[model samples]
Target: MQDILIVDGYNVIGAWTELKKLQKNDFELARDFLINKLSEYQAVTGWRVILIFDAYLISGKETKTKKSKIEVIYTKKSEKADQKIEGLIKKLQNVKTRIHVATSDMAEQWAVFSQGALRKPSRELIEEIGQIEKEIKRSTANTHRSSSMTKIQLDDATREKLEQMRRGF
Candidate 1:
């Protein structure tokens, strides 16, 4: 079965306290942070994720997407991100596919639910992501060490060269 995670980009930024502060000063930074976190999550988990942003205010009305195996959408001038996500649910929803929408907006949650998709509040998503991050950190803790530190393993060639040099010295 296909699993999809549809996120309201701005709504999440507004909901997450850290991102909320970033959003006030630099909206792009908030968006980037969300994408970076989600990108890591996607790499760790095998869910198809799409983040929708409202670019309705931009006069040129651009629709750009990024492929970290995740989609980033900037909605058209005539439509809202919520509308786009609802439409996406209609297109992707099926008995075999599960769609999960993430947003703190109550009306939007109900809207996606009507289309047979589960809704996740931003706070809940944030908490979940935090847990996942901790897990990743714990798992990767010993994977890398400072370059100047002790060598856990050395190449055979380097070991042989060092042995020869030591004998000559």
Candidate 2:
């Protein structure tokens, strides 16, 4: 089954320490950071990510989706981001599709859950992101583990050179 993630953008920014601090200084920075973070999460997890942010006086217009390999929506001026998320949950959910919603808002979590969408708190999402980063680092490391794991032996001449260096010989 294909996995889909519907993220509450402002909610996540408010929940994540780094994002919250960035938001305090620059709204654009926070917005960009959220997009980049979601992009990374999508790349690592192979999930379809859709991010929603609220707008005022949304004209009951069709959602404007930014396709940067992920869907980003600025709620059509009148709708709250949460409302848009609920609409999306209704539209995207099916028996074969696994939908996960990320937000710290309890009401939103319950609402999405009632729609058969699973909920993940922002902190737990961050921890999972950290684990993904660590996995990526370990997998990309240049260190030679193959030889050590097999207990391969070093030649006597190489060992002697190491011993001479240790004794200043």
Candidate 3:
């Protein structure tokens, strides 16, 4: 079965420490950070990620775009992120897909749970992200180690001696 993850953007940003701190200085930065994290999560988990942001107060039409291979949606004016999420839960429901909604909102959790989608609280998602980061670090370290082992590290004197030997000196 294919997995789909729906993220409540503001709720997650408000829940995560780093994102919250970034939001204090620049909201856009926080949003971009969250999107990049989600993109990474999607890449690692092989899940389809949909990140939804509320634009009710900004007075903009609904917008959908792809960032870093993840789908990002901004709610239309007067539309709440919860409402958009609920609608998506309804539309994306199917036997072949298992949907997971990530947010800290208790009410939204209940709503999505009733729709047969699993609820992952913000902190839980953060923990998973941390684990993913650790795995990535471990993988990178292994790759670096393997690549480094392949290179010959001879000092200049040793290299010169080898060259002389090869030339039948």
Q: Compute each candidate's TM-score over C-alphas.
A: 0.82, 0.78, 0.89
Q: What is the lDDT of residue 25 in candidate 1?
A: 94
Ranking of all predicted structures according to TM-score, beginning with the best and ending with the worst: 3, 1, 2
- Candidate order by lDDT, highest to lowest? 3, 1, 2
Q: What are the per-residue Cα lDDT tens digits for candidate 3 across 1-169?
A: 9999999999999999989998999999999998888888998999999999999568868999999999999999889999999999899989899999999999999999998999999999989988998999999999999999999999999999999999999
Model 2 TM-score, 2 decimals: 0.78
lDDT for model 1, please: 0.88
| Candidate 2 clashing pairs, residues 3+ apart or interchain | 57-77, 57-78, 58-76, 58-77, 58-78
If both were scored by lDDT, which would come out higher, candidate 1 or candidate 3? Answer: 3
lDDT of 1 by residue, 1-169 (tens): 9789999999999889999999889988888899999988787778889999988668556487885667999987888989999989999988889999999999999999988899999999898899889988877775554543665588999999899999995
What is the lDDT of every predicted structure here? 0.88, 0.86, 0.94
Question: Candidate 2, residue 65: CA error in Å?
Answer: 3.7
Model 3: weakest 10-residue lDDT segment is 53-62
Lowest-lDDT window of 10 residues in candidate 2? 139-148
lDDT of 1 at 41: 74
What TM value does model 1 have? Answer: 0.82
